[model samples]
Target: MANVSYFEAWGMWFDGRSTPGNDLLGLSMIWWGRFGKILSFVAGAAVIVDLLGPSRLSRYSDRLTGFLARRTFMATAGASFVAAITFLWITDPIGMHRLLQSVLCLTFVTAAGLLVTAVSRALPATHRVIRAASRERVVG
Candidate 1:
């Protein structure tokens, strides 16, 4: 399983309908080097929380949130690609792709950080707009 192909690795990583060992969640055996499954679950949960935040898109600020969400999605996908490359390389599927992995992770992490900042910056503005709109509706 260590030197499995990219297609097979992906099948294990994604396909829920696959057999027991083929499941992506079953990948702990191969890449459980440090952080372990708990960390992975936390990371996945954080991404979901960010995507499903309470901000409604009807507000002007939610537009920025949408932008942030799109950018974050791309950054995360890029990171996933890099991580898969690293995993494959480390597993001897190809060789040591550590350098490529590091580079890809670094780039995507920076992009993600910037997108997070953009979302943060818009939060206050969005909140203010929503509050004002509410106040106006109540008054009228």
Candidate 2:
């Protein structure tokens, strides 16, 4: 019989092999999973707040009502999609490539929605910085 180390007998090989291009996908999926929960919670809270009288979140004057509605729908759908994929993939990893494609699609949509929201939130600060720089250039 060939000599086997203790760790090898125990199946604890410390090989440093990795799946290329999978790290980013794995991290992105994790973020999406967490962000999905947050979005769902926010959506639930928004609905509760709306139920209460005169809430600021559902105000229609600034078009935030429509914006929030769309995002909430998208987030909920994406979360459900991710959950379904996870369940099916866990049951059988044979079709993991196909499952990953589905997950990537949902993650990309959620990421895009988040990116747009972030850019919109930063617009005022960005404008302020530009105005301040322009004023300094003119004055100096």
The C-alpha RMSD of each candidate to the native structure, in angstroms, is 13.3, 17.3
Error of 1 at 61 (Å): 12
Candidate 1 residue pairs in backbone clash: 12-24
Judged by whole-model lDDT over C-alpha atoms, candidate 2 comes out at 0.53
The 0-to-1 C-alpha lDDT of every candidate, in the order given, reads 0.58, 0.53
Residue pairs of candidate 2 with colliding backbone atoms = none
What are the clash counts of all predictions, listed in order? 1, 0
TM-score of model 1 relative to the true fold? 0.34
Encode model 2's per-residue lDDT on 12-103: one tens digit a residue.
Answer: 22564322223232353345457879999999998885575342322332364345445665655555566556656564555557667667
lDDT of 1 at 130: 69
Specify the highest-TM-score model's number.
1
For model 1, the superposed segments whose C-alpha errors exceed 4 Å read 1-96
